[model samples]
Target: MRLTILALDDVFDTGLTVLLDTFSTANELAAAQGNPVAPFDVRVVGLGRQVRTALGFAAPVEPVDAVRKADWVVVPALNAKLPHLLLKALERTDVIEAVGYLRAWHAAGIGVAGACIGTFLLAEAGLLNGLEATTTWALAPLFRQRYPDVRLDDTRMIAACGQVVTAGAAMGHLDLALWLMRQKSPELAAFVARFMLIDKRPSQARYIVPDYLAHADPLIERFERWARSHLADGFSLQEAAKALSVTPRTLQRRAEAVLGKSPLAFFQDLRIERVQHLISLGEDLERIAGQVGYADSATLRNLLKRRLGRGVRELRAELQ
Candidate 1:
């Protein structure tokens, strides 16, 4: 694979190094094993010979022109606070040029892969439209708003839309690299995994706090605040709509458009999240179940199972 890594100012250093080191290890392992396992020609390229990172360090790389001859192009995650990072990234002349470069390279049949906030770059270029992709879970609201045409599923750690792949938050780079390596040689991918002590992680939902993305929009924000207050007891969609001075349909629309959950289900998710938090503090399951309006631990267990695909024991461990 002729892999070219696109480095930009304020790049997520950890994600960048993960790809570089992993692929370097892959090449070394392939050479040691020989024959069937082919080496990955990983080239790190920046706007210039060097690009500044958010961590106060500078990364030196080949010029961007190197991507012209590459078979795969990689975009590393952004390192700064997301609000600032997105604004700054979209404003850069370098990003503008890179978007064009990506459109051209991908049209020429080169695979494009992005990790975390780096997926936003692909979204900005309109390359991910109508494709299933994942970005940092916390940034899903922004991604959805910016690229509504793209199918955004942040629950999965990696989403492959043909030759373009988008990965979830920060450490997702490891998963993305492993997936790419596996595509090349599953045997070599296994060998590399053992060497790196990395395991496959397929979901980001457990780590996501429910209703967290709701604050991105005013309508969603208002609903979230009201819902959180009423989670101690159950509330109806009509009551919530009346309280918010909107019709039930309006609340439904806002809930679906902003958070992608029905109002009743969203309310239940908030309750579940509250239970998880209590468990993280070592609260008793029976006690939490009652507080959240569930009759007993059995009912709570069913709720967790229905929404999160796990029981209280596993969900507690995940949140903690």
Candidate 2:
């Protein structure tokens, strides 16, 4: 399938550069894979033939008419001084025009995606109101404050529900593009990952960590870090307690009080995360089993199957 992406050249130079580079790289990778299907076709659209950036530079832009023909519309973040009269005036007409195009495309069964502060435009256009979205971590508070109706999840690199997809700050744009590629062509996604030297797969979860333990807990945090560093060596709870200068019973009690789980349970979760990470990186199941403290590959297979509903090979295949 040929995907046409209309990238909005907002008043931000750095953000626009990143968006263009990432989109181009992803498209080139997909094309190089030699798939019979045509890869992505991207165009930059804005208010007129040219738009000035915050840094006093001008980026030539395609007319807004291009958006009407796009399969997907992408709005990069606008870094111009906001809450000002100029911004409000621009949003009243030009910004609204771009957003209206996105809404109309959505009505026509086309997809719309936004990166970082661009989500504000999606929200303003009513495409993201009452939808689960994500943006940069630094701006998440401001986003929630301004648009209380939108559910903002900052933990994920990208969050999408329905037709609107929002990505987080910086490199998360690449993750979002990769996800779109994966949906369009799984084989192309694998080829792109190889071309880009990226080994990890996209995660579907909104919050990898549980909500109850969101607050800072120094002991659990320390233990979790220690477990990750020592995953290859395999440490026992007794050893962990000794490292923390506490008795095993005392450590277990404190862990339960703070994290609402026993020490061993938390350790098991960390082990599972490590094992999954290793498996996603293309580690052999037998080697992963030994590295994560399992007696054999069979035991590790059972554990992974019970926890993730998939064995090692299946998980690896899905990621690759």
Give TM-scores for every candidate, taking all chains together and pairing residue i with residue i: 0.91, 0.56
Candidate 1 lDDT, tens digit per residue, 44-161? Answer: 8987888888786888999878887887899998775456568777878988888888888888888999999899889888899889999888878777777889888888899997
Model 1 off-target regions past 4 Å? 32-38, 316-320
Off by more than 4 A, model 2: 1-10, 80-93, 198-320
CA lDDT for candidate 2: 0.67
Best by lDDT: 1
After superposing all C-alphas onto the true structure, candidate 2 shows an RMSD in angstroms of: 9.7
CA-lDDT, candidates in order: 0.85, 0.67
